[model samples]
Target: MVLPALMLFVAVVLIPLAMTVLLSFNDWGQYKGIEQVFILKNWREIWEDDYFLEMFLRTFRIAVLATLITALLGAPEAYILNRMQGRWKGFFLLVILGPLLISVVARTLGWALLFGGANGVVNKALMSLGVIGAPIPFMFTETGVVVALAHVMMPFMVLSVWAALQRVDPQIENAAMSLGAGHATILRRIVLPQIMPGILSGAIIVFSLSASAFATPSIIGGRRLKVAATLAYDEFLNTLNWPLGAAVAVLLLVALVLIVVGSNALIERRYAEVFR
Candidate 1:
C-alpha cells in the first residue's frame, strides 16, 4: 500500500517538481529550441513584472491571513472536541472535515452564491437591513479569497490541534489546577504551552495550503485578485508561456518549503523550551 502511494508521489509530485525547477532556469517552449537559451532572464522578467510583484504580495498576505484565522478557530474547536466523548467527537470531526472532502469548485461556488454580484444572498440581507445602498463587493476581491481559503484550510488546523490535544496528559492540567492555578492561568500557562506544537504544525499546514491554492482564489476572487497560483495558471494557460509558468511554479514551491522549514524550526525550539 505504502509502496504504491510513494510511487504515486514520485510520479505526480517529485518528477514534475524536478522538471519545473529545471524549466524555471532554462527556456522551455513547445517547439522552440536553444535559440532562446538559458539565463537569469526568466527570473529577471518575473522580478521586473508589476503583475508578478502585486500578485506575489497579495498571495502571501492572503495565505497568512487565512492560516491565522484557521489556527485561531480550529484550536479551540479541537480542544473542545478533545474533551468530548464517544461518537459525538467523531461526528463533529466529520462535520468540520466534511467541506474539505468536497471539490474546491463546489465550495468556492457556494461562496459565490452568497457573495456574487449585486444580487447575492449576503448582499440582499445587507440591503434589506439598510446597512449599505449597494452590494458590498465580496466576490472577485481579496476578502473573498481569504474567506474561502480560510474555510478550506480549517480542517488541517483542526486535525493538527486535535492530535496535539490528544497527546497531552490530562494529569498535567489537573496538577496545575491542584496547584491553585486559575482557569485562565491553566489555559494560558499550561494548556496553551502543551498545545503550541499542534497549533504551530496546523498553522504551517494551513499556510502552505492557502499559499498554493488556485481554484479558491480564481473562482471566488475571479480574475481580479490574482494570487501566485492564478498568476502561474495565466502564464501557462492564457499566455501559453510554459517557461514563465514553470518559473512561477518553482517560486511557489520554494516559498512553501521555506515557510514549512522556518515554522517547524521555530515551533520545535519553542516546544523544547516550554517542556524543559
Candidate 2:
C-alpha cells in the first residue's frame, strides 16, 4: 500500500525536482538546447542580481501579508460559522466555496476592472462621494496584487480553520464560561490552543499559494510589479533563459519548503504540552 504511494510521489515530485535542480546549473537558451556545461554562473548571477533578490523578498512579503490578513479575518469568520445553527451554516459555507467555482483568471480579470483608473467603479464611486480629486492608483501596483491575492486565497484559510474549529469541544468552551471566564479569555485560552493547527495549515497554504500565484499578480500587478513566480515565467517564456528560470523555480521551492517546515516545527514545539 505504502510502497505504491511512495513510488508515485517519487515519480511525480522528486524526478521533476531533480531535473529542475540539474537544469539550474547549466546555461541554456531556447535554441541552444542545453549546452551540457555545468557551472555556478546561474547561482552566482542570481545571488549578485539585485532585481532577483528584491523580487524574491517582495514575493515573501506579499505572501506573509496575505496569509496574516487571511488568518485575522478567516479565524473569526470560521468561529462564527462554527457557532451558527441550521441552514445559515450551510449557506455561509457555500458562499466561502463559491470562489472555487469561478476560474481564477476570470476572478483576477474582474479585480483588474475594479481596480482600474478613473473610469473604474471604485474610483467613480469615491469621486462621486468627493473623497478624492483623482483616482487612486491600484492596478499594476503591489497593493492591488495583494488585495486580489487575498481574495483568491481567503476561502482556503477559512475552510482549513473551520475544520479545526469543528473539532473543538463546545463543552470545553461552556465549562470555561461557567468558571467565570470572559469571552475573550475563553477564546484565547481554550479555543485558540485547539485551533492552532488549522491556523498554521491555512497560513502555510495561503503563503505557498499566494507566492506562486501567476494570474492574479500578473493581471493586477501588470508589468510594473515583478514577483518571483512572474519573473520565472518571464525568463522561461519570454527571455527563453532556461537556466535562470530553473534557478528561480528552485529558489521558490526551497523558500516554501523552509517556511512550511519551520512553521510546523514551531507549532509542534510550542504545543508539546497540549499534544501530550
Candidate 3:
C-alpha cells in the first residue's frame, strides 16, 4: 500500500524536481525545446545579477517577518484556545479558519481594496478618527505584502500551536501555579518548550508559502516590489527564459529546504543543550 503511494509521490514530485535541476544548468536562449548544450551560464548569471539577489533577499526577509508575526499572533491565541471549552472554542476555531475557505486571489483582492489609496476603507476610517492627515502608503509596498501574507498564514500557525498545546498536561501547569511559580516562568519553562515543535512546524509552512507566493505579492505589492517568486514568474512567463526561471526556482527551493532543515537542527540542538 505504502509502496504504491511512495512511487506515485516520486513520479509526481521527484521527476519534475529532477528535470528542474537539469534545466537550471542549461542555457535556453530563445529556444523552445530543451537545450542539449548544457552549461553553468544560467546559474552563474543569476547568482551575479544584483536585481535577482535583491529579489531573493526581499523574498527571504518577507517570509521571515511574516512567519514571526504569525507566531507572535498565533501563539497566545493557541494558548487561550487550549484553555477554552464548549461552543466558544469551536466558534473561535471556525473564525480562525474562515479565511482558509476563501480563494487566495479573492483574499488578496480584498486586501488590495482595503489598502487602496485615499478612498480606501482603512484609510478613510483612520482619517475620520484623525489618526493621519493622509493615507499611509500600503499598496505596492513591502508592508502591504507582509500584512496580507501574515493574515493568510496565521491560521496554520494557530492550528499547529493549538495541537501542541492540546498534548500538554494541564495538571503540570496547575502544579506549577500551586507552587507559586510566576506566569512568565511557567510559560517560558514549561509552555514554550512543549510548543516549540509546533512553532517550528508552523514557521516552516508559513515561510515556505510566503516565499513561493505570487498572487498575493503580485497583486498587493504590485510592480514596484519584486520578490523571488514574482521574478521567477516574469522570467518564465513574461521573458520566456525557462532556464533562468528554472534556476531561480531551484534556488528558491533550496532556500526553503535550508530554512526547514536549519530550523529543525537548531531546535534539536537547543533541546539537547537544555536537557544536557
Candidate 4:
C-alpha cells in the first residue's frame, strides 16, 4: 500500500526537485541561453552578491513578521471562537474564512486599491481618525506585503488552534476555578500549554507559506520591493536566466526545509511528555 504512494511521491516531487537542482548547476548566458554543463556559476553569484543577500533577508523578514502577527492575533481569536456556542459560531467562522474563499489575486488587488498612494482609502481613514499627521506609504513597500500576508494566512492559524482547543477538557478549567485558581492562572497554566502545539504548527504553516508566497508579495511589494519568490520570477521570466532562477529557487527550498525541520524537532522535544 505504501509502495505506490512512495513511488508517486518520488515521481511527482523528488524527480522535479532533482532536475531543478541539477539545472541550477548549469550555465546560462544572454546570447548562449542555457548550457547543460555542471558549474557553480549561479550558486557562486548568489553567494557573492549583496543584492541576493538583501532580497533573501527581506523575504524572511516579511515571513517572520507575518507569522508573529498571525500567532498573536489568531490564537486569541481561536480561543474566543471556541468558547462561543450555536449558529453565531459558524457565522463568525465563515466571516473569518471569507478571505480564503476569494481569489488571491483579487484579494491582493483589493489591498492595492486600498493602499493607493497618499490618497489611498486606508490612509484617508487613518487620517480622519487622527491616527497620523500625514499619509504613510503602503504601496510598493514591505509593510504592505507583511500586512497583506498576515490577513491571507490568518485562517490557518485560527483553524490549527481551534483544533487543539477541541482536545482540551473544559472541566479542567472549572475544576481549577473551584480550587481557587484565578482565571489568569488557569489560562496561563492549563490552557496555553495545551494549545502550544497548535500555535507552533500554525506558525510553521504561516511562515513557510509567507516565505514562498508569490501573488500577494508580487502585487503589494510591486517592482520597488522584491522578495525571493518575485526575484526568482524575474530571473526566469524577465531576465531569461533559467539557471539563475533555479538556483534562487533551490536556495529558498533548502532554507525552508532547514527551518521547518528545526522547528518540528524543537516542538517535538518540548511537547514530548504532553503529547505522549
The most accurate candidate by lDDT is: 4
List model 2 lDDT by residue over 1-276, tens digit each.
Answer: 799999999999999999989989997755776676789888999999898889999999989998988999999999999999999999998999999999999999998888778688888988999998998888987878888898899999999999998788899988988899999999898999888899999999999999998898888987789899999999888888888899999999998999889988988787896668
RMSD of each: 3.0, 2.2, 1.9, 1.5
**Using lDDT as the measure, what is the rank order of every candidate, best first?**
4, 3, 2, 1
Cα-based lDDT at residue 203, candidate 1: 84
Off by over 4 Å in 2: 29-33, 124-134, 273-276
Specify the poorest-scoring 10-residue window by lDDT in model 4.
267-276
Q: Estimate each model's TM-score.
A: 0.87, 0.91, 0.93, 0.96
Query: What's the lDDT for residue 88 in model 1?
Result: 99
Point out the higher-scoring one by TM-score: 1 or 3: 3
Cα-based RMSD of candidate 2: 2.2
Residue lDDT tens for model 3, 1-276: 699999999999999999988988876766565575779998889878788888988998999999999999999999999888999999999999999999999999999989888788888998999999988888988888999999988999999999999899999999999999999999999899999989988888999999999999999998789898888888888888888899999999998899889988998898899889
Compare candidates 1 and 4 on lDDT and give the better one.
4
Which regions of candidate 3 fall more than 4 Å away from where they truly are?
Answer: 31-34, 127-133
lDDT at residue 170 of model 1 (Cα atoms) = 95
lDDT winner between candidates 1 and 2: 2
Of candidate 2, the 10-residue stretch with the lowest lDDT total is 27-36
Instruction: TM-score winner between 2 and 3, please give it.
Output: 3
